[model samples]
Target: MKFSAERATLLKALAHIQSVAEKRNTIPILANVLIHAADGQLSLKATDMEIEVVEVIPATIKREGATTAPAAVLYEIVRKLPDNVLVELDQADGDTPLQLRADRYATRLNVLSVDDFPSMGAGELPCRFKLNAGVLRSLIDRTRFAISTEETRYYLNGIFFHAADADGVPLLRAVATDGHRLARVETDLPEGAAEMPGVIIPRKTVAELRKLIDEAPEEIEVALSETRVQFTAGSIMLTSKLIDGTFPEYDRVIPRNNNRILRVGKKDFSDAVARVAAISQERSRPVKLTLEPGLLTLSASSPEQGVAKEELDDNRISYDAESLEIGFQARYLNDITDQVEKEVEFAFSDSAAPTIVRDVDSPSALYVLMPMRV
Candidate 1:
């Protein structure tokens, strides 16, 4: 479309939307970004069929028109241009190729008919509410790391968002897990989200939204149905279909009465896990947790290598019951504790039962990790 926009603004918008377009496409038009202009505003849209991103920017719409061009090439060229340059798109010379002009630098990119681009389905979006950017960021960062990359369990491939009863009070929760470990974090239910159905946000969208949250948009408008979900923040909007499958019932696996408690400094625990787990095999880095009256012991060993034992002071570590030795994938334990902001508490039912780690203050955020038989 014929429009003029700030070089930096154009570059940012292009970078955001173009990521949704896959590098290699089975269809030619799938690699091109659809450009639309009207009312002095330009919109850039790119889709890989499953996900679609639309970015709008303020521009001088000299002529209202629509066209498509390679998303990657245009993004790179615009990104490399001089700072503060005003980019102008012109199609008035009776040439189908749109001329990108910025000061002395210019390029004529062959444009395709916008009609061939896939049309994004914008359903009747009603449910929406504003949540703090800080809250959204917290929900994603804490849980996204545990999302499964395994293609077999497609249902666990994204973070689960839904309303649930936490501490006997209504709350909105986000959960993600592979088979080894799981993260469950919840926040107070936002207004207009009381009846929102649970949806599994795809992994790609989880990552993309993390980048956009830096804008600190006022309202994170969310809309979802049984099959699809959409999020609108700042001048960008993302839409994607929900994963069509049933997520495993994770609550039953959460150890409810894990009475054995050990309070340890998060940083110290993470460091010990990192050092000891290195010597163990990648597949079975089962770091054993041995709790005594006043000490917390972390030990690991391998047949190929020797063994290691680290004793740390945990003032509250009092386990009168039989000495419990719970084994866990040290890396998984580290992932759950690395992002935690403060003191970390590990609770266990037994050496064989599931072990849970939680913040000493934040009851809403909990991690359930399966134990290994060492």
Candidate 2:
């Protein structure tokens, strides 16, 4: 294959493709990216058996051919090349090493058989829709922090996406949980997604997709089947195998009658929690919340680090519920609060029951946190 592409353009495409290739692989071809040059464009493809990413960039084609080259090595070479320099790639045949040249620098990368690369095809995607990039970003950013990292539960390792009805209006929802905390966010359902089946997108796929969409166009195309999902953003296309498992009915865990309400500024609450939790040396970093009609106290204690406490009065907090004390991991509380805007609302039933939290300005997103012993 022979082609010449601008360094900036080629480097951007390689950065997206090379990340899909696994750093360690048993198969030789799986560690390489398939490079094809034809019809005034260069297509780069890389996969790790489960997720595949392909990106096409405009290039000056000298010959119509294809070959495989080490993805990481090629990416590094292009990245180091001077900006605005034109990168040239050439290979006589599949048996010959690929030559890369840019200005005064030149290198040869060992080639692999392009026929050996596996393809994870998006088979018969029946459900197709379009979503605004900003909306999609909101759904992922608010919920992904709660995705489970536990391997045994496999089913809980990704965000659950499906169509549901809120009152009489249909909405698309993303829910994630790790048994201790849960995040649920929803947006208005788009056209052609009413009959879509619920799917669990793997954690890795969610992360990769999020990165690509950061600078994507205003609108993103989405197509999915029961077993696979595909996202198309401009010149980049990603196909991933969905996790085949049933997500638990998450609604049962959300608190319904936690009538004791507390409204506080997000900055004040987060800052107070951070200060008190800094004194703890435990892995969980437990912080206690002592609440009264018009005051809230945050405290933490450790055998080696001693005790720390901070208080917020009625001026910064509005609470009229009976006095209550509850404990929670400082890290988990921070994760949920990071998504909130100006103010945070907390509903409590007792010291031991699950607590409901929400952003006072964003009604479409909700969170649930389980209390711990202080």
Candidate 3:
């Protein structure tokens, strides 16, 4: 089989697909990328079993054939070739060794048998729909920071996505938490999404797919099966297996009937938290917030370092009692507010109960921070 293609086109396809190939794998085939040349299009596919990506590009195919070669090496070689140089790929005797050439740069890369490559087969996707790429990007961007990295509680390691009520109507929701902080965001439920099962997409898969979706076209087609989900956008496709575990029912954990409410500028809260957290020790980095009437005071102290307090002027704290003090991981609070587009509303009952924060007019997204003992 032989194919000739512009260096830039081949490099782009390889770059798109090679990111999904595992750098080091126990099985060598997992590190190899499958190259298929047919018609006037060329396809490069790679997978790490859990996540797979395939990129398609237009090429001049003189002979139709498929072969597997080291994904990293091929990507690096093509990246170094001249921009418009044409690359030609062919097999010497249709055997295990493949010939690769592009002008002065040529190499014979050892090929893995195509029979050993594992391709995921679609299993009758019960639920499918179209999601706007921009909306999907917003959901991921605003909440990914709160996803748990603790492997022990694997159930909380990804965004918990489901259908829920938003202002008494049906809506699609995504929630992520790491015990200390929680991020919840929602969008109008798209048609045909009510019956879909809630899936916990792993963090690694989410990050990899994020890059693909960033450059994807405006609309993306999503198909979800019992165990896996596939996104087809433009000339690329990504398939990933959902994490197999029960996501914690976080509804009960969210406090209800909180009486204290404080409305303040999102920027002010974030900056105050950031400055106070700087002096906090690494291990128990807690910032104490004192709310009383119209005053909001942030303070933090470390055993080796003295206490520091910063007063925020002209804020709205609807409490008149002795200051209601709440301690929290300053970084968590800052992360939740950093994405806020406008003012923030902080809800609380007492210092011990969890506090919920949200944009003034947008209830679609909510953030919860569990209080820490300072």
TM-score of 2: 0.99
Query: Which candidate has the highest lDDT of all?
Result: 2
Model 2 per-residue lDDT tens digits across residues 1-374: 78999999999999999999978868878889999999989999999989999999999999999998889888998998889999999998879999999998888899888888888788899999999999999999999999999999999999999999988999999999999999999999999999999999999999999999897999999999999999999999999999999999999999899999999999999999999998976769789999999999999999997999999999999999899999999999999999999999999999999999999999999999999997
- Which digits, one per residue and each the tens of the lDDT, describe model 3 over residues 189-222? 8888888889888898789878888789998888
Question: Of the candidates shown, which would achieve the greatest TM-score relative to the real structure?
Answer: 2
- Report lDDT (CA) for all predictions: 0.85, 0.94, 0.84
TM-score of each: 0.94, 0.99, 0.93
lDDT of 2: 0.94
Indicate the residue-level lDDT of 304 in model 3.
78
Query: In model 1, where is the ten-residue run with the lowest total lDDT?
Result: 314-323
**What is the descending lDDT order?**
2, 1, 3
Ranking by TM-score: 2, 1, 3
| Clashing pairs for predicted structure model 1, backbone only | none
Candidate 2 vs 3: which has more lDDT: 2
User: Which wins on TM-score, candidate 1 or candidate 2?
Assistant: 2
